[model samples]
Target chain A: MNHFFEDSVFFGVTLSFLSYGLGVLLKKKLKLGILNPLLVSIVITVIVLVVTDMDYEIYYNGAKYISYLLTPATVCLAIPLYEQFEILKKNVAAILAGILSGVLTSLSCILAMVLIFNMNHKQYVSLLPKSITTAIGMGVSEELGGYVAITTAIIIITGVFGNVIGEFVLYIFRIKEPVAKGIALGTASHAIGTAKAMELGEIEGALASLSIILSGIITVGFAPVFAQIH
Target chain B: MKYLRQFGIILFISFLGEIANYAIPLPIPASIYGIIILFLCLELKILPLSSVKETGKFLIEIMPVMFIPAAAGVLNVWGIIKPSVIEYIAVMVISTIAVMAVSGLVTQLVIRLTGHSGHQ
Candidate 1:
């Protein structure tokens, strides 16, 4: 099976598209509240890699074409952000205050764990930006001599996990306000979590988008200072 | 003509961020430095909304794709990461829920205190 498709772009794109497509199909059919398309796709891809014993480098080589799309996708977020600026501006103070508090909470908890476990600085630094998005978190972690791979894993896990349970917890607490729900998830979990918040409602989606950026900015601002303290 | 100036401003800040990241002793990443510079620019009216809006919008749209590169790292850790998959999974699941609960409660409390009453 591996020899047949040793060098083919279709290999990567097909696996990616198929995994995500099937995941989305499962999500719709099963009505599984937390079955994220991205997560499921990733799992499927990993299983393929392991089963076929194919090299990850080869898979990435084929997928590199699609990877270029990331820049434009990031740029697309501006539309919603611009559209929702009115709400963001109106509640800027409260929202900022809440988001910052949540960020602080996540960082503090991670640092506390580091100390409790008696982990070394390498582990400590890797987890420093655990709550932020992967790109930024990986960068910060590498600069501080931490493991970027671990940090990236932590960031994605945090994002997918936050997204999966975020809405349910909101319902559990009887917190129905779209704006509040959006801000909470985005600030705590970043973009993927925000995407889930969007599914709940437009207002929630808007707020989540706004919060994701704001939280990223805040995390960017706080990471250095926080890292220094630890 | 105006758009040109906005583009220049963003590019300049991005450059400044890179420079500061290399030259300064601050323990922060450069792109983040750019974000800080941009944030200050927005606050000071040095970079108007109309100008930076397009560039900012561009970055936000494709934000998800950024994960692709990092997700690639999963490959590097394949051998090591697999051993503790279940442990990591538990942490991932539990911590995500914890974050949602705590952040949601805190946000709602703040909203209630602020008295917006917009929540429906």
Candidate 2:
């Protein structure tokens, strides 16, 4: 076990890569709707834990090295947004207006529920960053004394549900433009939703990327003010 | 030249994000500061198209890898989450559905208000 402890970081990175690889394999083989890489990585990681009985701390010790990859990965999100600059320029005001309102509305509804339900401060803070992706959500949770675990679950669920049902709602409502359809899912669910948006098409993916960037800014900037109000 | 320009944009946004982390007292972390700065650059056209497109592409390509940290945290709290596994799953499933539904409604409302509903 001590030998395993020394190799935890190596193990963690191996698991991370394996999760990604397995996800790709599963997607190719199964054509499963909800079997996205992130979800797959999560399932695989949990199974590994249960079988090894490695405990969370030891596993984290192994995985912390790979954890640093998140920072660079985050720094890289600017790529797609940069690639889609032309489309964004064509419809700047409309996209901005749509994403902004959408983000604000999300915060309002979540906060309103928090207050109405009388969730304590931690739960409220945890849920505040719920609309964003997991990294930012954790950051938001940490800053506000919210439970990061709870926030992680919220972010994942937000992404999965948005990806699963976003298209149906858009079609039912007859949203034809790829850009509009993309922005709606991205704004609501962040990156996981953005993955689904990308699958829909380039235009939708672009809009979703724009939404991810905009919603992240809007949600982070506006959340504190709203938190103070309550 | 293209890579240089992209790196420059990344560095500039990173700087802005760092500054935000220092300046803002909010509990929310500040990498989002980079996101805000990126938004402003796009809005202002200061970063320029040639500067970041390549870099942005590279970044999103590896987006899924970024979740490693958050998922790792699950390792830390497994004990707490384990005993209450059913409760935790319920919270994850129920709250997720509720939040997504609410967010969709908001996006739809915004689309309608902007008179762009018909455009879609």
User: Judged by lDDT, which candidate is best?
Assistant: 1
What is the Cα-based lDDT of residue B49 in candidate 1?
68
The CAPRI classification for model 2 reads as: acceptable
DockQ in order: 0.26, 0.28
Instruction: Please estimate how well model 2 matches the true structure, expressed as its whole-model Cα lDDT.
Output: 0.66
Instruction: Give one digit per residue, the lDDT tens place, for model 1 in A1-230.
Output: 66656678777867776777787899999988767777777778888887888888788767776665443343334445555556667666667766777777766766666665566677667777777765567777877788787778878778766766776778897776666788778877877776676667666766776666666667767767767766
* Candidate 1 runs further than 4 Å off: A1-4, A228-230, B1-75, B80-95, B117-120
lDDT of 2 by residue, A109-145 (tens): 6666666666666666777777676666777677767
Model 2, position A49, has a per-residue lDDT of: 75
Question: What TM-scores does chain A show, candidate by candidate in order?
Answer: 0.90, 0.79
Residue-level lDDT tens digits of model 1 in B1-120: 765765566666767877877998755445556655665666567755676776555554334434443454477776655765554455455555655666667777777787763343
